[model samples]
Target: MARDIADDGVIDGLRAAATADFETARAMPPEVYTSDRFLALESEHIFSKEWYCVGRSSALPAPGDYLTCDLAGQPIMVIRDNDGNLRAQSNVCLHRMSTLLQGRGNAGRIVCPYHAWTYNLDGSLRGAPAMSRNSGFCKDSYRLPQVRCEEWLGWAFVSLNPDAQPVASRLGALEQMIAGYDMTRYSEAFFEEHVWDTNWKVLAENFMESYHLPVCHAGTIGGLSKLDEMICPPGHDAFNYHTILKDESLRIACAHPSNDRLSGDDRRMTYLIAIYPSLLITLTPGYFWYLSLLPKGPGQVHIRFGGGMSDDFKGDADAAENFRQLKALLDDVNIEDRGCTEKVFRGLSSPLAQAGHLSHLERPNYDFARYLLDRIETGQGAV
Candidate 1:
């Protein structure tokens, strides 16, 4: 009498909607955006099993600097240990299961505010005050469970699955494609968290295709875009990308004068890369910004937003001014996208909402739907 989380009808509809060829592809089923059951499937299959990007590596420059994230309902922490290694471990206390940290800051040891149980920076139990009274209390037996953590380019990623493939191995092609940009040298200038009332995919799709730029971002960078200049290629297994040539007027979007690696259109090109399961980056020649997404439920998404200028601009006298202007523009762009994506979620909730035909510009969206179906279907088989 229980409802099936992986409804056969919905799976069939999703498969039909996710065809690779744009000529035959359609929008994903509305239930994909509206069903709590489907979100549960995604959490189990995609979020938990796949590598989730936390943020840039440069953010944790010194030992003891740490950040905490709630990934698929599992509270995890990433810290720079005394050995200069980035480690990810369970953030919950082993003794009473209390969360050990709040927001990000430097800590010599993780101390549970509840009972004063403490852990070293490397997650080994440092002390359990007065615990020797108990017969079975052994400090050697207690350490926060370690999670898989990796640094790809400059981003920090963590996966809950022990056997998950290495992040660098999965993203080799992406690295080669972006080699000229030297993304690792780009520093993190700012990071922020926000919750929006929209399905995560809606915002992701909005980012994948700039088809809505002229309308949704009309007040900001929209007018600078040209549909003909946009290129949405078929996605790879781990990621997808589209490129647009920045208008000459937006100088900061183009390569800095000292950047000699890129030539021709590549110098002015901006690559929109969506690393599956939820890291979306806008990599321009001189600057980059990204959104790492986590779903709150079917109706809302939590976003980690950050960006900074390329190292090529580090010595330029105008670099600071350029970044300030760029940040302001991006903030305005985010406001526009929120309004548009939130409205789409509202429409998707309607009884009359139906899957529609795809525009060639929306090829990445179609590919994303296929990625979702593949992960969820394969996960169902495992279960």
Candidate 2:
């Protein structure tokens, strides 16, 4: 006899199961989305333990080039040293723990403005003005604490914990899927960020669902993928890593306006993949965009969208026009989706809310949530 998926009991909540089954469902519990205590647990358990993508490596192309960004509430500096090697270190000065750099720049060395402690671009302590001669003060012992850093598909990933698995090892087959693509052939054209109020997991769940595209993104993604065609399978396979939502009709309408574009292979399509924990990569024929999610608190997250282009897209006049159109379309889609998610965050605060379910179509997202819950529950977190 065949097994009933309902009998598996993979889901363990009333509202959770209900919400996953219905399209117009209530939001998750208020505490899970709005509690500071829960947010701190996310910082300790999930953010600290997993490999998180901060920004693209293209943001720092030259030696001594650096970008200061936060890692799970802790400030960090990702730099390319004089030797062209990338390194991650705490962005706080060792003296009084002051923030070293506020943003991105090219620097000869990292200097503390407070007490003037200077460190090499590689994070090695080189000088401590006025304090090198202090008793028992050894420059060797004062180097900045380093964090694990790695680059994949031209993006930079950082971890706050020293014992976290190497980024590559944790990615497993994901690394190979992206490796096949010529990632270095692209460069950023524009970048922008905005903050949303919600649990980081909520945003992850939202991304995994395509059911809302028709209604929420009518002006953009709705113009392309229909509901049935956007159905995605569950797995950590290549498609999951580099999946494409093809719609040749839309592509032709945007590309060769003079030609009556119909259903075909060269028509419009959207490809989106996640570099697990915090990076979303999307591509169309004309443009490529990466969205990085930074959790600021239980109810707050920063989302950045950066666009890039391949030589093929850059040189072709037709492709450039299509790219611009797609960019505008994507911007609209993102704004609409964010509005929906933000509204859900507010609704999550209702007193009657509870946990939700996982639909077969939403199994990937459910697995992701469970994976995060396991990590946070078992990790060194606030009890």
What lDDT is reached at residue 133 by model 1? 83
Q: Which candidate is the best by lDDT?
A: 1
- Which residue ranges in model 2 land beyond 4 Å of their true spot? 1-30, 176-181, 237-244, 249-269, 318-322, 354-360, 380-383
lDDT values, one for every candidate = 0.90, 0.65
Per-residue lDDT of model 2, residues 1-383, tens digit only: 11112311322222253334334333334455566665666677767767777677888889988877787778999999888889999999988998997777888988888888899987888888787467988888888889889986677888877787676566666655444334565678777777887656677667766666678778676656666555455545212432445565555222233323223433344555665676777654435777788787666788877875554455566766766776776688778878888877766666655555444455456445545445554664324
Residue 100 C-alpha lDDT in model 2:
92
Alpha-carbon runs more than 4 Å astray in model 1: 1-6
Q: Which ten residues in a row have the lowest lDDT in candidate 1?
A: 1-10
Cα lDDT of model 1 by residue, 30-51, tens digit: 8788777788888999999999
lDDT of 1: 0.90
TM-score of each: 0.97, 0.82
Error of 1 at 323 (Å): 1.2
Model 1 residue 163 CA deviation (Å) reads 1.1
lDDT of 2: 0.65
